[model samples]
Target: MKIALNGRPLTDQTKAAIQALLGELARRGAEVQINDAYGQTLQEWGVMHPFTSLYTSRADLFDADFVFSIGGDGTLLETVTHVGERRLPIVGVNTGRLGFLATIKPEEIAQTLDWLENGNYSLDERVLLHVENDRDVFEGTNFGLNDFVVTKTDRSSMIVVHTWLDGEFLNSYWADGLVISTPTGSTGYCLSVGGPVVLPRTNNFIIAPISPHNLNVRPIVVNDSSRIEVRVESRSKNCLISLDSRSKVVDDSIRFTVRKEKFGAQLVKVKGDTFLETLRSKLNWGLDIRN
Candidate 1:
């Protein structure tokens, strides 16, 4: 089996885990490839392996059967850029705080790999958002597994976001920002702002305001099939637009539309692991404080 590895900067703890994982893979005779940037980081840390290939671009990962994302959820999100439309299955290893997407811990690596090798895993298809704008933005890869955020820039006051669903008027949100999240992202920024936690297969999108001026304004859930159009009015000429972890400054005049992407992100899930289990562990759900 051919596997690809990608990650952000690693700490000592993560490096040790990665080393162990690589050693196990080598012993099993699996062909391994590392993202070029991550390979350089490994070399800097004096962790070199003769059996691994280093790939510099997305095309280099085309032949990979699976891509292991090491680090936090942000690292996994970055891996999406490399996978693009390839729909590669990603296994996220948690080495950072609040790893909602990167569910597997370092201690579980060996067991997880064993399951992966024996075909004891399933693919969880997570929906992605395809962003459209009047001008070129976010390069050509405009799909995101999480939410798309539009907000005011630093030093600027709260902006007004005029929203529409399927060309019908929604509302003018007077707030710090707005979040349009997929069901997969409902647990993320959407939840922080009081949005409902949606199940993965809900086929819905969440519209939540960030610090809305009106106290009565509440988050709303909409059908994923609906096309969302947004226009921003900010005192500052620019606004901040972010897709998952990537962000850029854009003119307030830029019209934006978001819809469900044609393809979804494929997440690897081994048997006995469930989303509810992750929620309980990560969010301390059902913890008995009185105990």
Candidate 2:
């Protein structure tokens, strides 16, 4: 079986962890490969194995049986973009704080990997978003497993966003920004911006305003099939549109339409792990009150 490892740079502990994982895979006789960005980090650690290959392009991962995301949720998001529509299952190993998406703890790496080899796992399918802009910022179309956000940049003033749902006008939001998050991303920036947490398998989407001018404009949830449109009108030169972590600059005259993609991303979950279990453990969702 082939497994591709991807992670973030600028951290020494992550570098060591990758080396140890690569060594373990070799001992188990499983073929291993590293994303080019991470391969450089491995070489810097002075670890080399004949069974390992370095990925040079997206084509290198087409045949991978599994993709191991070895960092925080951000790195996992990055790995998703690289996976595109290949639908390869991914296992996120958390090496950063607030690992909602990167659910596997670092200490349980060996056990989790063992489950993978023994087929003791579940493949959870998560929804993805399709984002398009009237302006020619993106070459074609883009997809995000996490979310699509339209925000005012650091120097930009608060913008007015006119929204429509399934061809019906929703409301005009005057705020710092707005977020259209997937069920997978509801716990992320969406939560920070007052959006409710949604189950990973829920067929819903959320429109959460970021610091809205009116207190009555609460975050709204809608069916995934709804076609949503957002028109940005800012006093500044441009506005910021982000699909997951990738962003593009667009003129104020641009309009964004976001909806669910035809397919979803498949994530590898080890046996006996549940999404709510992670929530209670990670977020202390039901912890007792104490001073």
Instruction: Give the TM-score of each candidate.
Output: 0.96, 0.93
Model 2 misplacement above 4 A = 49-51, 134-141, 154-156, 289-291
| Per-model CA lDDT versus the true structure | 0.90, 0.84
TM-score for candidate 1, please give it: 0.96
Best by lDDT: 1
After best superposition, candidate 2 residue 51: deviation in angstroms? 4.9
The digit string of per-residue lDDT tens for model 2 on 221-254 reads: 9999999999987888578888888887777787
Error of 2 at 183 (Å): 0.8
lDDT of 1 by residue, 160-237 (tens): 999999999999999999999999899999999999999899899999999999989999999999999999999987
Best by TM-score: 1
